[model samples]
Target: MVEADASWRDESLGARVRVALWLRDEVGEGGVFSKASMREAIKGTEQVDRRMRDLRPAGWAILTYRDKPSLQPDQLYLEKIGLPVWRAEHRAAGLRQISAKTRRYVYERDGHMCRRCGISAAEQYADEPGTHARLTLGHVNPHISGGGANAEDLITECARCNETVKHLTGVQMTKEQVWDRMKELPVQGKRQLLAWVKTDFRPLSPAEKVWGMYRQLPAAVREGLEDDLEALMRS
Candidate 1:
């Protein structure tokens, strides 16, 4: 009976909850461990990497080699563990299952572009050159508790920006710095800025909305449509 009762201490819990427990019990904070060790500890679970990534929005601060160059490629460091997903109260933390309908609505509402950086699906960032953006829904406030699956609570975010916002290195431009740049804008630019700020979102123009949808087409279809649009414009 005691053996069977200890399931929460092991696999009877959700994979993510067990993963959090295993990390807390085994690794502690600021400890480094390899993927092999984690998989061994949490055997029979698929997408262990994904479950680990899911913990981040709950404010767990796991770091990779990308975040900390001292670590090996296959290694991950547990900087801080956030929610105790093993507990009943917090099990739902960071695990909002966004429905397909709501997902589509949020994407369309945001013009199918990442709200954080305005990068459309599969478009390369101007600064990052050659790296393409992959769009995903992110919480309006990722670090907050109970970030639900509701459309109003989510924003379209590219994978890159989503990860950056989760980590939040705390060294971005200050408000004064941004305001100084905003002050440089002309009257029309200032008006456009006011519209976005007032609505707390960037409203897509009709042409831009069409472009956002057009960008989602397959490469060959997009190329053909590009030609078709050009020809129709000339006629």
Candidate 2:
């Protein structure tokens, strides 16, 4: 157990604060730690793992197995520390709670798809076809000095794009590769593609809107509707 005066030992502190303290004092930078051990020390803290992740926005670099290949599934490595949230002034740092209204507005504005990749909620990626993308809200100008929590400041994104942008990852495709595909488009298709590039968003057609909504229906219902549509077309 941590000493009584330790910030991590104080039950009165917020779970996020205590988790940060635990990592700083117990784990240290570039140290390996296990979730089970951290949980045992924090005691009764709901979603301790989430609390640790919450520290990231404040500059913490806690790495899970997903981020580091050498680590065991249950192990995490503390790469870097950010804010000292134990101090009162830094307590709410990087913890911007977007309003429910703002979240809905951003998602609705972006047509419920990732603005970066054009993948709708729960849609599979073209490269990793088996894995479905999870949608989330990302800041339109995340790296800006004064980004805010408003509709204009946010955009809908797949969680993958959000992480990639934050990390400034490599491009998904090369220019030549993409240019070849562009050249393959027919004249009308080229015109349509140029419009999307100019606006930087793909507007869904009315039929596409219906198709997206219809995809959420149960298999039985979808099959029944397909039959109805086929019959109607036959008539």
Candidate 3:
């Protein structure tokens, strides 16, 4: 028998453990057990319901289902946490597995703004209540374009802009295209543009990254060398 944690006992852990063990023993390998069977085996409806909730929080039980009894299609089948290797395989595939620290670093690097529209994370929340902040890291070149999951290839963007650019066809645009677009904006628009650009402008290669960094030089520097910057790009 697996040892039950003492702290877990307060949260219907004993009932949950009984349910887990009962399912493990009676249910064949990879076989599905109905909720009704579990309730009967445990001998109480309320106890089974309470124990099922508790088991979920402890990660010991997973609710799966099969469509055998065609008439009553709503019944769920219970399975052990580790019964199917496919469960583990599917989980591994589904999990992005990015660490919290890495996520924070990406956010900090992007200055908490959307790469495409320059919307700050705070603005995104204010504009769309009940939504999370808009600091998502996205790939510069998609995986289809041979981009790997690396810091150099990732940049921050708001969810909307990220989704919009994700469907673009043909060759990926260069950072120069980004800068040229910025030049077309009015003062207020430019300010908003710069804010997002600063946050979401990481390039996929060291050379491109360097170019992007220089492209975002302070407004004062750009003002003094605006003509020169344009001329340099052209030549």
Candidate 4:
């Protein structure tokens, strides 16, 4: 077992490691605390909640009201601390280690785009201009315990979609906002979206598949091909 060599108050350690340290020191096993309190302690850092969720894979047993009905919605119970993440050896405790080959295969298989949103690498979001999407690999089911690092078990996702899919924090869009956008879709678009929703998979169209392939090309080559495609269409 690794002993606590550093204090949670140390700002230099990673956010996840500091969070583990904070929980260990401030909220020991069986201690109860609120999200606000945790955030207040770990000031100036973002995604404290997400960091807490990351500890679960390491064997941290934190529970919310949903898990323990007796607790208030704002309160969390620390059932157990699973790892001594403060130690160098356990720094990556409970995290999946994917092979380089597996990562490349998964990214290529998903067309180097976010499988959930179909946004290619370095593409800006329609709703959020100036924010380019950064792609990453996520488990097909983020909540699954001990999910494997196999290609079949992984999916390409943007950082935003990854956190949202993991239920790590609040989504950018609310239900009402999403419903409003859904209502604006054309009839055919609505039908297609419905089909995709039913299966929880959006099959890439021929054009999208080719677009993914084209996006993988070098920037200069992609620019040349863009002109070529336009010319070919005109021809």
- TM-score of every prediction relative to native: 0.75, 0.68, 0.33, 0.63
Instruction: Report lDDT per candidate.
Output: 0.82, 0.79, 0.52, 0.84
Name the regions of candidate 2 deviating beyond 4 angstroms. Answer: 1-15, 30-53, 61-79, 124-130, 144-146, 169-177, 213-235
Which pairs of residues clash in candidate 3, taking residues 3 or more apart in a chain or in different chains?
A: 110-199, 114-158, 115-157
lDDT (10s digit) by residue, model 3, range 73-140: 44544444532212223222211335677766775565555555556553435566766544567777
Residue-pair clashes, model 4: 0
Q: Write the per-residue lDDT of candidate 2 for residues 29-105, one digit (tens) a residue.
A: 99999989999999988978768766877878777666788999889889999878777777887776799999877
True lDDT of residue 207, candidate 2? 76
Please report the TM-score between candidate 1 and the true structure: 0.75
**Poorest stretch of ten by lDDT in candidate 1:** 1-10
Best by lDDT: 4
lDDT ranking, best first? 4, 1, 2, 3
Using TM-score as the measure, which candidate wins?
1
Candidate 1, residue 152: Cα displacement in angstroms equals 0.7
Candidate 4 residue-wise lDDT, 1-235, digit = tens: 3357688888888888889999988899999999899999999999888788889878888887766789998998999998888788988877888999998888777878898888987788999999988888999867775678888889999988986676543455789999999999999999999998999777777888788777766779989998998999999
